[model samples]
Target: MTLHRFAFPTAIHFGAGARKGVADHLRQAGCRRPLIVTDRALAALPVLAEFRSHLDGLEVAVFDGVFGNPTASQVMAGAQAFKQHRADSLIGFGGGAALDVAKVVGVMAVHEGHVLEYVWDHPQVRPIVHPLPHFVALPTTAGTGSEVGRSSVVSEDDTHVKRIVFSPQLLARAVFADPELTLGLPPAVTAATGMDALTHNVESYLSPAYHPLCDGIALEGTRIAARSLRTAVAEPGDLAARGDMLMASMMGAIAFQKDLGAVHACAHALGAVCDLHHGLANALMIDTVLAWNFEAVPHKFDELAHVCGLAGGGQAFVPWLRQLKADIGISGGLAQRGVRREQLPRLVELALADICHQTNPRPCTAADFERFFEAAL
Candidate 1:
């Protein structure tokens, strides 16, 4: 029998058209004026109007200033927009970046100071001990599961240093996970994002932690991804496959309360230093990290192989990961993605500084990251 110490606090309603009830849920949360925080690209889509249709009397405000790898400035602007609209709640509607900004925006709206003040880092700041606006997360994509996460990743605009602001206060009051919205995603985006979910599942499982509860969820999440991610990529119209991936993505977020590993460390650094897509960076780096990680936790690889439905244990995992990426049309190393060779040093520096990687199965020194980058290169 398996058990869990953590319970996902967000009320979840999962189905094909679950997003249609967002307004009712907001009302249940006692929110009147709601701000929908999303990205500019999504704001232009017809879906935006449909999302607002259900909120007829809510006096909805649209703040579409979210950006890729959400910047600190974007969070500030969103907070300003929320206050300007006198919004009572927030609807995080889009991909990971949009959801992350919404979480931070919810925090900033009621806080006394700067958005950066709450970051989970040194020059230590006060913990977020206050209540936040009621928030509803509606993910348009199947990856990033940011809708269910309790933290937001924001970057310093110029330096591109990623910082996480964590608080149970940031968790959405409700999550409307509707895979129907992902039916029109481009194949490449689907593939990349699916890999991000896989990385999350795998890393959380492998992270050196004692949470058997989280370990169980991580393994199950991987199984879900293994069964459905490729199908979702090949047949974007397959709602069932999309739903599985979305569930796996959300499970990854929940399970990763156990924390992530080196793949994320590398991906975050790559995103900050190279401005790469979060999913794509994780996709490209996963195999390299896995290969390095296998020796340290060989038994975990066996467990992963069984859960991921691979025929062979241990020895087969890394190769399968590479093959899976290739099958999804993701090939080559970091160099292929226009990441200059000279950037490796900077990426390593960023990776070492990333707090998220601290729980990696094997303690990673800066040298380990350099070698990891070299392998990817």
Candidate 2:
């Protein structure tokens, strides 16, 4: 086994009411005026009211323009808001989309060029400019672990392509993982996002990487999702289950730095073109992708099956996964979720372009991607 260096920079605070520490963390980071980036749905939540009251005497502006699958224009607009308010820091205050946009805003605030110019497209790219003010992430959902991740997903409005902006410096300086904030997630969102977390764990575990640490983390993360996701979805206010899912979500992100595979590649393409829920798209493709790749690395799936506590070795995983999905009320394939067969050609092309495809256990061509889509559909 080759030696690998692991370094995660974000300082994380986890537990119930962990969000209460945000103000103190901001002060410790020397952020007087911070821009809170969130979406309309989260902006109206009463949980944010406490943060607002905490900042009553301080300078804090809220930018609620962030939308699902954030766009480059939204990041530019957020940058403008950051500058206009003379904000000294950023607080990502919602789910993946909000956190991703906040991270991009932090990048663009210090960089001069158009936001898309900085996006690393698989090959080489210029180094990021000076890091923006300290970023504090407070997740209101238990998925997308964007708070601790270095890459931000943004959509190009014209092409409608979801592009990833990669930079180690984009990770939040501090993160608040308060499961209490996730108690209000709708059942559908809960099931979909939790499945997204499960995909991250399973795919990372299957990725052809040399990081045993990530493999172990992914295994445990998968276990947590399997055990807790359904409970969290069924009983939204169950703090213990919610906390487990939140930790699993963060673990999935950390583990996937080793790599993600066909599931994410398919989801990214479907999300860009069809505007389907990213997590749901991933959930639909995961089993099919797993079936395709299981033969390539049967031992890994065997291990995953063991961790998920199944009796059969590798083959048990898919049935367990399907059962989990059904238990959580995640029923339906990509076609049922609005993905069309006619769009397969374009979707296949876009899925090929996704960087995640490179890490798949089984290397896939455009034709392979088409087959995967057809199977999922």
Backbone atom clashes (below 3 Å) for every candidate: 0, 0
- The segments of candidate 2 whose C-alpha lies over 4 angstroms from its true place after superposition are 1-3, 122-126
Task: State the C-alpha lDDT per candidate.
Answer: 0.89, 0.88
List the RMSD of every prediction in angstroms.
2.0, 1.5
Q: What clash pairs does model 2 have?
A: none
lDDT of 1: 0.89
Error of 2 at 100 (Å): 0.4
lDDT (tens digit, per residue) of candidate 2 on 1-377? 56678877778999987887888778877788999999977898797787677665569899999877789999999999999999999999999999999998988888887788878873555568685788989888887888889999999998889888888898888888999889889999999889988899889999998888899899999999889998998999899999999999999999999989989999999989899888999888888889889889999999999988899799999988888888988887887888888999999999998889899999999889988999888
Q: Candidate 1 has what TM-score?
A: 0.97
Q: Which whole-number lDDT from 0 to 100 does residue 142 have in model 2? A: 80
Local accuracy of candidate 1 as per-residue lDDT tens digits, 1-377: 65545666678999999998987777876889999999999999988888788787688889999867899999999999999999999999999999999999988888878778788784868677678888999998877899999989999888988888988888888899999888878999999989988888899999887787778889999999998988998888999999999999998988898999989999999998889999999999998888888989999999999987788788898998888888888999889888887998899899998877899888899999999988888
